[model samples]
Target chain A: MFDYKLLAALAAVIEQGGFERAAQALGLSQSAVSQRIKLLEARVGQPVLLRATPPAPTEIGRLLLNHVQQVRLLERDLQDQVPALDEGGLPERLRIALNADSLATWWARAVGDFCAERGLLLDLVVEDQDVGLKRMRAGDVAGCVCAGDKPVAGARCIPLGAMRYRALASPAFVARHFAAGVTAAALARAPAIVFGPDDQLQHRFFAMLGGEGGFIHHLCPSSEGFVRLTSGGFGWGLVPEQQVRGELERGELVELLPGRVIDVPLYWHHWRNGGELLASLTRHLEKYTGRWLVQV
Target chain B: MFDYKLLAALAAVIEQGGFERAAQALGLSQSAVSQRIKLLEARVGQPVLLRATPPAPTEIGRLLLNHVQQVRLLERDLQDQVPALDEGGLPERLRIALNADSLATWWARAVGDFCAERGLLLDLVVEDQDVGLKRMRAGDVAGCVCAGDKPVAGARCIPLGAMRYRALASPAFVARHFAAGVTAAALARAPAIVFGPDDQLQHRFFAMLGGEGGFIHHLCPSSEGFVRLTSGGFGWGLVPEQQVRGELERGELVELLPGRVIDVPLYWHHWRNGGELLASLTRHLEKYTGRWLVQV
Candidate 1:
């Protein structure tokens, strides 16, 4: 059996991003927090945290954190059953990793009801769809909404639906770049808008057209800014169909190739033992995601 | 003299977050990029990059990166003056760190005209008002909008004005939590909505009312979601006055203590030698910020 207090110390250190802040959160002294970490490492026979400006967990530390996250959920379930175990009747806080596009488009509407109904609070960590699973591996979130369908060990992945992204640009951009023809070669020459370095939607779209090399691109990390840049004639980008309805209707933005759209499948991943709350959220998303996302 | 090629390789590695992607961006082999970094470190007689999963700059590395950022701006100015030096007329990209609240409220409208007129592109990195200057120190961005008025060495800080925030909650939340009276003790017991662990606005607000020590808070990192959580009766939070006008008018939300407001002063930090483009942008912001931000 593991010492739950030690595990809590480890989790708090990673979550708060430093030992000092973790100590404050835990209502312990900085020295005491450091001592707990030392004890934890001594018991494990290895270092749990890398000694850095802002400490990060080692591989063993990540495994322990994963254990702590599951324990937290199970504890919450227990607290629900035994009201005496509840602390101050504070709503449970659930850390989630979600893509920015979802947060910008339909996330609030989809999850707002569940959160309010359950008296749950969310701590959202924004990550790219392609790499959101890393947050799970790092034990930074209880669950994640990401593109890939694979689940990490001890986690379940469920299909929520797909976000249909159309290759969109301002009408002025289409006239300037795609006037000659919307071909793989032409796309390679024209500038594109990438969400960030981790985003591969543009690369995948290009690969689908048999264009396999690098291209001219501008990186814009914000979902709102991504759409604004696309419509402002900065560059063509893959934008969610749901998000661009108004722009499309106004004729401000147009598709690069009409009818050519990429359906990025969205998956909800949660710990297998994440208890009733995650289960309820899963069911809720499965029921309501159809309204905003296309069937895959 | 510093070799611009070596500097370009360093910038690309940090910007792309990895050597392979940096190599791809620079149209070079991964091994060549590694060699460039090694050569740079050898010349500097110290390590430039932290050999981490996602490489970070060391202290000297940050200094060099600051130099590189300024040089890029100067090069763009030079290219603008000498059209023959321009490479394919690609718009120059300026990365700036901004707080999410400002980004959600008034950023786009404030900078839209300037970007369009100058044919420039933006890569915005979202950081908290208190910690945004760290991005500039880490050499992650060319400029930053943050709460601090002090500039780092070799940078200029300009007062951009202020964002006024009021402690607001859903009408239902206010009635439930503040029915007795909105005292410091009542506030200490009531749940609050915090943007993140980095956000100190709630703490500052409470401190202003002579309430010290921690309070229960639900962290919602997204600006839009923060408002929704507050309006949904999850918790009271300090929200930008500009963002809550509609909710305020609709009677969905109300201030806990009427007429009690917190005005957070904002400052823009840029490298001293950031050249004509930065100078022009600085002037543009000075001319237009008064239309959006309250004078401090």
Candidate 2:
């Protein structure tokens, strides 16, 4: 098998794009890095690096780099477990990414409770569910709770649960714009609320309505802010059942589409090597959300 | 955070249930495994494994194992990219889990061709899309192609595409059972071929018929067998469009429900570490299956 250390050194060299730069970054002699590469090529029976003005990875080199990264992540995970050998020190910090809606609703509170109980600190990054993986890819956070099934490279994923959405409007807004049943044409004329430019629920709604135009839309990025905007009669929006249940019961928000609700399956994605912190967080979230999210 | 090595050792120990067995499996001395466990406990500030009887992972230990496994996958990925420092063989063989249908259809051929070009070999395990994660959890495979949004803990996932299923039957079977327009009652008497005992396509069809019963099913474990059984006048089955398109054109099989087809979304799951071979394999699969599987 390939020597992991040597492969790592070669990766650093390729990433730095030159032996000199990679050697400096790795605190190794340039000649040593060169020799390492030579040895590697002999073993693989192919040239992994193309030495030129700027060093570049051959296709094989790219493959090796990918492998090296995975090994590194595994190593890091092993390192994390070393701390569990004792119980005296403070727990290590965790970093996570989540959608705004989940953050505003029960997710944050649940995470806070977990952190407090475990004596762990958490760094949270908020983003749209569609783009949460991007943050994870950039290493801005170690894990993410998002809607998509796809995980970024080098990250582990799990199913927390699904989030249900119901079409809702403030009683006043409904009274103004939806006096008649929501017809294909009438919906196009009504005002609607969207989470942001990237939000596609409204688009999906229109598609379900046979691609007819029906509504003008207002953009609200924050989950809390979106709720407020809808409650203040800005427009109709799909609200999470858990978040707007009280409003619906209190007659503040009316279910526009009572029988037909949308369900977005939510998943948890994290660096596969993220350790105990992510597991605890995932289990806790699943325990609570399992009761709420749609089964399947 | 948890130390990955400690967690891995703990998981292995728990799986093996003895220091000797665990050490043998891990290629380490019994003393090394013992030392690693001690270090792990110190780091986690809790007892991760109970030494009574066959060793078992504590809740905390299980949690740590989840993280460590994910990281290890990532590390493997990283290692794949680096060049070797000495003359040695390629890294360890890659293990993968794939949906039965994908394996039987074009995917197997595509993957085989790619691996041959790259001088890599893969160990493949066939599984249903729904249960592929369980295999990954048991460490049976390093990655999987499954049909769900949620991934197993410490595994990275991405959307592979979709598999479209059309209700199909042999011409002879259709002539005998479906001469009359198929209704819920008519379907109940018809014999159907299904992928396995856990196959639910027929149930889904029944549910769509206002909860009426439809079709008695014959379980076939192989995707290719399911198609052949249906085409050879055994029963009707929901077959992938790609798999049945040729047969349908040849009048060997006929569509039962032309407009109403089931669309199953598929996703790719693997250890998150950057493995070059895995990445290249994934890219090739994605490119080949693009539009062939789903619109995306």
Candidate 3:
């Protein structure tokens, strides 16, 4: 049997990014936290943590973390069923990894009422849409929203509709860069705004356009900043249709290639045994997300 | 003399997150990029990169990157003077690290016109306000906006006013959590929405209120998401005054402690010898940022 106290210490250390902060969060002395980690490693018969600046979990540590996450969900289920087991009425915390674009647009609206009503708390880790699932695989999150449809060994993946993006730029940017016309070659030559290196939406768009070589791009990791940079004539980029409705309507931004859209299909990946709470949240997302995303 | 091509390869690898992608960006074969890195490493007589999943630069690599960044700015100045020396008229790229609160609120508005007019493309990296200068110190950015006023070696720091934050919550949340009145004990027990692990804004606020020990927090990394989550009644958080003006006026959000504000002093850090273009940008920020941020 695994000791939950030690498991919690490991989670706290990883989340707080240091032993001192973990101790502070856990209301324990730094030495106590360090002792707990050492005990856990001794029990496992190998090192569970990488002794680095901000400590990282080793492969075995990840498996233990995954087990801890699953056990937490199961515990939530038990607490829900037996109200007497609830400790201090602390709101349940669920860590989920999600892409930035979704968080910026419809995610809060879709889940707000549900979370409030259920008295649930969220720890949201933002990653690129293409790689959000990695957080789940690394045991850093209970669930994730990503473009990948395949599920991890103990996880289930559900289609959550698609976010449609259009290559958009400001009127001034179009007048400056696309004066000759929006061609693949012009796109290759002109600078574009990318969310981050992990974001392959622009690369996928280029692939669809049959442009081979790498294009000049300016990295702007924030979705809001991406739009602002694009509309400010810094570059053209794929903006989610839902996010730029006002911009498009106000003529602050225009389609670079009219009617050419990139629809990124999204999937919700959660532990198969994530308990009643996770199941309920999944149902809520399934019911509400269609209002914001194109049905996949 | 050092090779600029090797430095470019190093920058590309760091920016693109992998050698294959860096090679693609440079229009070179993977082997050629590998050879250049090896050659550079041999010349330095030590390992420049820590071959992690995403390669990280060693201390010496950071110094080289710093040199590369400075040279790029100086080269831009030379190109500005002698247009014939310009390569393909590619718009100059400036990498910067900044806090999310500023990016979400006043940053784009302040710099939009300047970037557009100057044809300067930005690669904006988002970091916490307290630690943004670390990016400049690591040579990952040409400049940064942070709470720290002390400059790194060979860097110049200028005060850019302060961003005022107020403890805010949705009206219903206040009614539920603070019905008895806003007290330090109650505040510590109630869930708070934190920007991230590195965000000490809430902790600082708690300290000012004479509250000790760790508080319950839910991490939401995005500024836009933070506002939406706060307004959606997830938790109370210290929100920028500029960001929540609408929510306050509309009565959707209310101050947890009225008139209590946390003013984080902002500073702009740039390379000391970053040449004419960087100096102009520094001047532009100095002239305009006060219009948005609270005068320090």
Candidate 4:
């Protein structure tokens, strides 16, 4: 069996950038850090880290670091379940990957409440859905909320319900550009605000009408900025229901197409055997995310 | 030589999700989309697309998609140089990846001004620095502004300047937490705000005085939220100088440690062969980022 202490040492060296810094983090002398690494290398018969400026882990070292991080997560979960180990210390910081769109809208407030109630801390890796799942599969995060329903090779997939999106444009924009309604010709004339090329929500909506060509498009990556730009008569966009609810009610934003909506199915992917801590966490997410998302 | 038309068809299929939708996007029949894919696969002597329910690209197909994206970027640059292809239409939308820290502070305004002045549009891929560079190398984006000096292989690295970070806390938070001076014991009691695990700026600062233990942290993924949380006296945090200058000047936030700063050097990584178009863009960045960043 691999010694976790050695793995922690290896991870510390790569993350903190040098043996001296790692030693400082571990409250050990620099010589002790070197000795631990030497001993660990003797055990594995391979050097784990490259001796370079701002040292990076070798392939094997990277795998070991991943394992160390995994173990650290498991330890946190253990601490959460068996509170006898708390011993008057703070809650362990659990890192998870999530998309920015969710974070900006309702997810943060909901997750913050849950984390606070549970006396837990969170560290988020904010990225696109696919990348978040990829990070989850790489063992970088405990779980991820993503756009797909499929679970990674060894993960559990929980359907978090679809987030319904509507084509939103300012009334002024409609007056200026799309006064003739959202037809194929009108679509060609009006500029559309897109998250990115890989954002298929617009395409899925566009396919029903068969008119996505030769249109000027603005790409705004930030959810808040996207809403601001869309609300301020910049362009038309596909915005989530929760994000546009207040604006829509206030008549600041209008749905380009009535009745028709784009629904993006999001999933929570986590290790199936994540135990009590994750199970409890997912239950809270189910309650929060389920309420925010549209009915399937 | 590969048939770019066939590759484009395949990319549309994967991106748009089905052959039928790809046909719609291309303004062609579904059968024609299938025929193009068949011909492309025949040329490669292997299936490039899996033809799965949602449609996915095979390994070779992913590479070709990346290549096509590269060619598209080159074509935009070429169009910029040739001028004949303007054809009285809108300017090209260039996709670039950059970190949130840059986005929330001065980068967005600078990029917006540059794009406006140049008659160009921008699609930003927002993520952490290393992830941004990875996307650049994979041809998912044309360029990225990121921390660190290392450029991806075959990319030009320009040292934009160092983003100096400072440990900051609200006056009320300092009064409550550091009334006993900033000791390791006090640090253990006082919570901290960090961007993520890879954000070791706090730890680097924490190590100099040496106290970091089980301190509660609120992981705010958004730079705007980070500043908001820190300024509201929720916790002490290491914020970039540019981001917190207004708050610092107004006495809403104070530096936790004076004279101990974290200088995170940021670089502009772009294709070396990006030609006159990218060169002009970089010149603007040098003017903008250089002016905003501290001389260190």
lDDT of 3 by residue, A1-296 (tens): 77888998998887777899899888799999999999999999999999975688999998887777778788788885698875445567788989888888888888988987887878898886545677777666878988888898788998999999999989988998889988888889777888876777888888888888678888888987787777777788999998878789999999988999999999999877788889999999889988889985
Candidate 3 at residue A221, lDDT?
Answer: 86
TM-score of chain A of 4: 0.81
- DockQ head-to-head 3 vs 4, winner: 3
Candidate 3 clash pair list: none
Worst 10 residues of 3 chain A by lDDT: A85-94
Off by over 4 Å in 1: A1-66, A85-90, A167-191, A203-216, A228-235, A244-260, B13-66, B80-90, B129-131, B168-190, B206-213, B231-233, B244-259
lDDT of each: 0.81, 0.65, 0.84, 0.73
Which whole-number lDDT from 0 to 100 does residue A9 have in model 4?
81
For candidate 2, give the lDDT of residue B74. 58
Instruction: Give lDDT: candidate 4, residue A107.
Output: 66
> Model 2 scores what on Cα lDDT?
0.65
DockQ of 4: 0.21
TM-score of chain A of 3: 0.88
lDDT of 4 by residue, B212-235 (tens): 533456677777557765776667
Q: By the DockQ metric, which is better: model 2 or model 3?
A: 3
Best by TM-score: 3
Two-chain complex of model 2, DockQ on C-alpha atoms against the true structure: 0.01
Error of 2 at A179 (Å): 78
**Which candidate, 2 or 3, would have the higher lDDT against the true structure?**
3
Q: Which whole-number lDDT from 0 to 100 does residue A241 have in model 3? A: 94
TM-score (chain A only) for the predictions, listed in order: 0.84, 0.68, 0.88, 0.81
How far off is residue A76 in model 1, in Å? 2.8
